[model samples]
Target: MPESIGPRDEGDTEPVRLPDGNLEHLDATVRQLLDQSAEQARQLDNLASAPAGSPFAGFPPGPAMPAPAPAPRPILELEGEEFESEVDTLTDWVETFLMDTYGDEVSTAAPWCLQWQEHEDVLAWLHALWLAYHQHKEPDAGLAGMAVWHRDFLTHTMAAVRAPGGSLSACMTDPDRPAHRILPGPQRSARRTGASTPDTGEAPA
Candidate 1:
């Protein structure tokens, strides 16, 4: 109801002076509003350009997608042909060992020795024993070498091959025919009788 204020005429151009403190306060308020607007624009720009799973979106990049597990190694399976080849090699090695070590005595004293090749069980057992001895024989076993070979290896093999129902015995047509013989007389005497006799068929008198 009081007298209404009207807009000033363009011709009234006199400048009005404000208080220094008021001018300073108004300037500070304008600067603060401008700085807030700038910060909001920068944040908007970053959001627009960010990747799908970026940490800036909100949550940290989902636990770096767990690494894939390593593949398992394949198992080795031995085939039948491989097994047979191994057996043949083992058999040949055993036969060579016998011929090299006791060929003369075996040929002279054990005439049935020629038939050993035909007996698979005999070959297998002897080959196994020979493998064990070849692995563990002592370097310093001089005379004892013959003793251990004849007693442990030879005797065991002969017994296995000459048992009543053994491979060698099964091949015999005559019941009275000997399937095998002990180590030659002199070889046996040298081992058991403690006589320092040579294995050359000479009796220790």
Candidate 2:
């Protein structure tokens, strides 16, 4: 009770005595903290000096990306004799297909018509139609393919070729004479029988 210790002031940083081992431990701890602080400062400096949009400013770079591939081309671009050969082949196949599929309907539906295989314009149109239609002619399409051929392809083609002033009509007068009328169908047969029977002639006994 002879002397009393007072509380330390806020600004007090006076050195305290310690054992030799304790002093060495304190020195090593201070050096480690200083080293950690220096490393943090170095990283901050690098970030501040880095250029705009640099991935290294905040994170490391990753792997590079690959380029895209090119698109495919179509198969209907033959030239010269090759084009003629292709058209001929396609026209033959289509004509056979139509005859085998809907010969009777075509024979009556559009009686006065061009031989589509011989007519370049008709062949071209039909060939394109066949190419487009065949793409969807898998086994699953079944009767739907034939239905579409008749309803969409055949209907449009017959109309275009048989209309009064259509491609077939134009072909009738072509200098090359590539097209001709198909006869002996139901409509023509009826007309012929009617014409042969005279109005004033008496009935046979």
Candidate 3:
């Protein structure tokens, strides 16, 4: 099995080169996770701040028009500590690898090590990783490998947020907000219904 890796970046406000190889990809992935986390935090804040009956109050509409409304916020809350633990665990492995591979110079931050505790990128990765891991069940054939793959993919995907010169944000954004995932025809985000409206018996085109 290939060693699972996440994003790593030089700690400068700009970019720094690790004494070993560059972990730019890993850094971007971690940064993305942080962004998503921040967004989640913002989402939670929005939900918490909204008046009892605003448009964003209930869950937004789902694919099926009659389906249960979307919750304005996630019910199962993930606090900062739980999120950071996973990130920290991943970072620890990277740090250990660096120490073993390059020694004391490895003191540099792996995007997860924060100058400040509440970095949004770290939080986003946590939320994304949590959702991807918890929501998707194993496929038939009882495939056990995907979970690890999923975690690693997310780790790198989320970390790409700090690619030294490229649009790290655009790159990281692709996984979560895919450019071409939207299917053609009918409704954009979801499948359009061919069913009739309640008031009128005629089917809506």
What is candidate 2's lDDT per residue for 1-205, written digit by digit as tens? 5776554777676577899999999999999999999888878887887798887884433578787653322324556887767766775776677546644333323333445555555666666666656654766777587677667777787566555554455334433344474333236553545544366564423
Off by over 4 Å in 1: 1-79, 99-120, 138-147, 163-165, 172-205
Cα lDDT tens digits for candidate 1, 54-102: 7776322336677887532211122477645655665576567765665
Q: Estimate each model's TM-score.
A: 0.32, 0.37, 0.24
For candidate 1, what is the lDDT? 0.58
Off by over 4 Å in 3: 1-109, 114-117, 137-148, 161-205
lDDT of each: 0.58, 0.60, 0.46
Point to the candidate with the largest lDDT: 2
Q: Residue 80 in model 1: shift from native, Å?
A: 1.7
Residues 154-175, model 3: lDDT tens digits: 4564344333322222222322
lDDT for model 3, please.
0.46
Query: lDDT of model 1 at residue 196?
Result: 64
